[model samples]
Target: MSKLFDLGLMVRTYRDPLAWLTLFVDLLPIIAIVFFGWKAIPLVALYWLENLVIGAWTLMRMLGTIAGNILNLPIMLFLGPFFCVHYGMFCFGHGIFLQAMSGNDQGGAFGGGPVALVEWALGTAPHMIWFVAAIAAVNGVFYLVDFLILGGYRKTQPIAEMFSPYGRIVTLHVAIILGAGLMMAFGQPLLGVLLLLFLRVVFGMALNMMRRLKLDGGLPKTLDPFADMQVETG
Candidate 1:
């Protein structure tokens, strides 16, 4: 609990420019919440969309590590499709839940699948295409810089890449879903929207710090299942 609102953690985490880029991406939803008059549905939809973005980048990270080992090819071939189908349905089902909560289960939009969910989500949030694109761009930058150029893949395995996102996603969304529920219960007030934004940014900071600690081999045992893994020094 004390760790959740750790401002010092955020200060250290955002010292990296890439972290600032992540913050920028995370903050984009605020524009709709403020100026464009978005409510919980759009905000949560944007986050659900961002999860797909995260899955896309995670898949790339898995692909990036294949050259590091021969065994990884089979693993990648198996898990790549597995992650796509599983994560797609995971997000799709979550989208359907959000639609049901928002009082919409129309056959055309939420009826189809992930693509339809994406379209429905973007339509719900006015000018959300740009926000979603911003998130994808930040993810692309991180992949190019941290995963590729910084040789994150050199020290990483497909399995680690596969499971790392779940921890982050689950940690962040529990609070998000709770906040959304409260916001919806209260008639979607502006204060609720802003609190949701703050909650996401704070959770992002926490997860990013944990990620850095994992990379540098500084994460405590409680937080470091991959503690046996060493840091990438090259």
Candidate 2:
């Protein structure tokens, strides 16, 4: 474990192109927040939409994993629908909570369904679609270039792919909650937003690194990185 703390191993994250792409996608919102005057509410909406996209692509990853390994079929058949229903409700409930938080005297959590969620998100700041699109496009690039072209699916299991999005999701949610607390206490939205973004980027990269190091003799084969919530199954 001491070797895992090595500075060189951590700094090597800078050399990872995929990691850099992830960072780029994660940080683009800063530009929006700084130059375009984005607030925490719209940023929250952005992340909510990003969660949906991640869920969508995770399903694709599971399919790709199944395609690579026929043995994953049976479990995929059972777990696939279960994951959909569970993750959908999870997002739906979270969306309601978010709408409530940002809602006015009209009331909170008054949404009918997913359509309402999307409407609420876009209603806050329509321009966020561009950020959302950038996120989706970047994720698609990873799906195509890393997972497909590089045969990442060949190395990973369906179970790992299924749990993949949760690490980032949990990390961001925790950061948001902390940032929200800080903002509420200080009444400083800008400070909250900056801290939130910083935490998100650091934690996101760390989680991905932990994952990379865990699978297929990751850090044992080579020195690697870490995260607050280590989603490393291996």
Candidate 3:
């Protein structure tokens, strides 16, 4: 463990092109799969593995104290499956819902039917709760790590700061939910989803522009890089 700690410190101290390249390459096959479909799973898995390796390396570098990693290991283990199922349903159900809303007759595509709606609600419920929890957990770990490494700021302050992003994220999530509910109430959930998607896309682009300018923190400051990447590539 001590040896691994030394390695991670080394990586963090000296930025490596190979590490960044690995990240990019690891992400590339996943993109290709999105375009090409299941045929790319093998390559996708390969890339994912490489990405994990890079993540470990990067984590080691950023976190000198094993305490951060020790804490992150379990939460991340759970977060992996949590995000997979929640996001999988989020993607699949929301897609179907939007399609149905568009008058495509995609039954329960976006929770169109009562049964589908129930399933969609169930799938997203945990994420609604755990997303906040995971953010808190991660922030706690980072707080400890940062405190141990740099010895700056009060211990609790970092944890609070880390969770600050979630407050905004929760707000956006609520807006999306409210918009979706209004759509369902007005008997146009599909239209609501489509509009929501459109709003998300536009709002996302605007946020990206803000980030590029380092002008974050306002009405629409929360930016999910994953979401941005998806929109750009998607």
Candidate 4:
């Protein structure tokens, strides 16, 4: 009991530094989108949703240490789109709301066309460059956050002291590339989300497993397997 209590404290403390870092890192893309001049609101919206989901996941992982709300595969899977849509709405609505408040025509001048997009892109090229730079600079936010969150838990154990949430995100890019390749190869994008969700679950489970085995050094051999199984698997 004392051991468990101490462990919990360590995990919580380790997450503190990470939380501060994460808050700062989280602001970059938003700054990029706004300052870089959003060519299409949807792209900006995507970044916002992506950032939000990552933040939520980080928070949940921290809370899980004591609360044990360890998100299983299905929850992350379902929440992916929900998070995206939620963030999209938030970004777009905020833009429109501000525009309306300032007395700009509700649906003025921005036509939907490559030419318009290109023109907007050219106008914001410098801003877009800054946005891209910001993204590159802060790309490691997720991994750093994950590492700090888990590092908190490994405070006393043989557990790996560092793991990056961003590291796991590699799987996301890989999935996107692979999905795009498949779409080009076979001409279907329907499975992209499903594949991405599958990868997220597998990646999450792998991280947890690594933490358990590499970081925490696995369950004690003396601990009864049957009882442990009952606790974790039952």
Which candidate comes out best when scored by lDDT? 2
Query: Which portions of model 2 miss their true places by more than 4 Å?
Result: 1-5, 104-111, 211-234
Candidate 2 vs candidate 4: the lDDT winner is 2
Residue-wise C-alpha lDDT for candidate 3, range 74-156, written one tens digit per residue: 65455445544553444344434433433433455333543454343334322222322332344344334434544423222
Model 1 C-alpha lDDT per residue in residues 64-89, reported as the tens digit of each score = 88866777998899999998888777
C-alpha lDDT of all candidate models, in order: 0.71, 0.72, 0.36, 0.38
Which number leads on TM-score? Answer: 2
How many angstroms is residue 113 displaced in model 2 relative to the true structure, after the best TM-score fit?
Answer: 0.2
Error at 122, model 1, angstroms: 1.0
lDDT (Cα, tens digit) per residue for candidate 2, span 17-45: 77788888889988888787888888888
Give a tens-digit lDDT track for model 4, residues 65-155: 3322244335545554554455444434443332333344235424443233333332333444444334344434533433344443223
RMSD of each: 4.7, 3.6, 15.1, 17.8
TM-score of each: 0.83, 0.84, 0.28, 0.31
Query: Stretches of candidate 1 above 4 Å error?
Result: 1-11, 171-173, 184-188, 219-234
Candidate closer to the true structure by lDDT (higher is better), 1 or 4 = 1
